[model samples]
Target: MRNQVVSRDEWLKARVALLEEEKELTRRSDAVALRRQELPWVRIDKAYRFDTDEGAASLGDLFRGRSQLIVYHFMFGPDFTAGCPSCSAIADGFNGFAIHLAHHDVMLWAVSRAPLAKLEAYKRRMGWTFPWASSFGSDFNADFSASITEKQQREGGFEYNYRPAAPLTSRAAAGPVAEYAATTGADAATYMRERPGMSAFALEDGAVYHTYSSYSRGLDGLWGMYQWLDRAPKGRNEQGLWWRRHDEYERA
Candidate 1:
């Protein structure tokens, strides 16, 4: 390889560019925080249900038997080949934050449209301790347009077939050529879009309120450093391994 090193001036320019970008990101985040406060929320009218280790639960029951609820709309759908690389990266940041968030009367959960069995199993594989639940049978995933819709699934769901026709595997789907296998580039990604992350209703004043949610691209800056690290010489462990065939693990 050639010694493609940057000169002092170029390095300074790069650093300056990064600082400018960081400032823009800060401005955008502050704007979004304001938007979160102004979010026009309506009462949760339907009886959305989810299955956890404890059993079935309503959307209101996600506070871990507490008053406030903070549900992260994790981006792993039942038909998805594997959890979103981006969401998994975000989730990697969740458990640590969860323990701390609990000190402030908030409980965090990683909820997905994947089946309880699949979601719980992956949770174990990732060695995550944070609470995770499944919204497989409910429209909770759809009403929010998290992942693919029933209609989109009707179009044969997104996959990474080894061949164009063969079912796509995690490795094949998320390879660099596939650009992380996430086309949204994290922009306003839905649960329907992989790596999308967001919280559900908040309970305040005996009412539920909308807070914040993000698509694959929307989380561009917060953990944005990780994606940069992905391109580093060390490479990112962003693809699935043991649980890649999660659906097949228990079948036989």
Candidate 2:
């Protein structure tokens, strides 16, 4: 339902009051960002490799000569015929911003567990030019806690966001999880095998260091659509998995 309508003078007063709070939030967000940058960085030593359009490339190569690298842990498992719709939604935003980030001494890539061929075909279908690499036989996704198997999900030994993640059970779950699972051309069990996240790396002195990572709701700000919806009249107004790939949306 709509909020109460008030006089123009009253509305102006309320808006001005909200503006002050928004300014304060902006200041707090800046401080938090500064603190995030101040976090300790852990050096990555393992030989992480990925399959790319230009053949095999090491984790360091992903930076593309940039000092910083941002990898979106796209949820496209080896068994999946297509990418996850939710991740695709996020990629829609990245597709536009990736180029701009590249020009600013930063590289952005979408890393998935799917083989290079599947990633290539889907990328063409989606018309995304952003760099996406396949980590099919690599531990890059597992090490970053982005990809998980039924065994890992059952045993539950890994940590996501520095906390114990809930164990995954093999059952037909309802709601968005099941809904999104269907679109991936995999059973719900196979679909739930993968999770979404993003990791940031820094390349310095011929070494790559894990600087930061975010998962689940921590990634809200990176989603451009939600950022816009948050300011809209209805403000998301989401009931369930109402989003899809841009091409999937029906024309008016």
Best by lDDT: 2
lDDT of 2 by residue, 116-214 (tens): 999999999999999999999998888898977788777887788779877776454556788788889987778877888999999999999999999
Cα lDDT, all candidates: 0.63, 0.90
TM, every model: 0.63, 0.96
**Best prediction by TM-score:** 2
Per-residue lDDT for 102-197 in model 1, tens only? 777787887887788878777777778999888888877556546554345345444321111233344444445254343323322232343255
Model 2 off-target regions past 4 Å? 170-172
Q: What is the clash count of model 2? A: 0
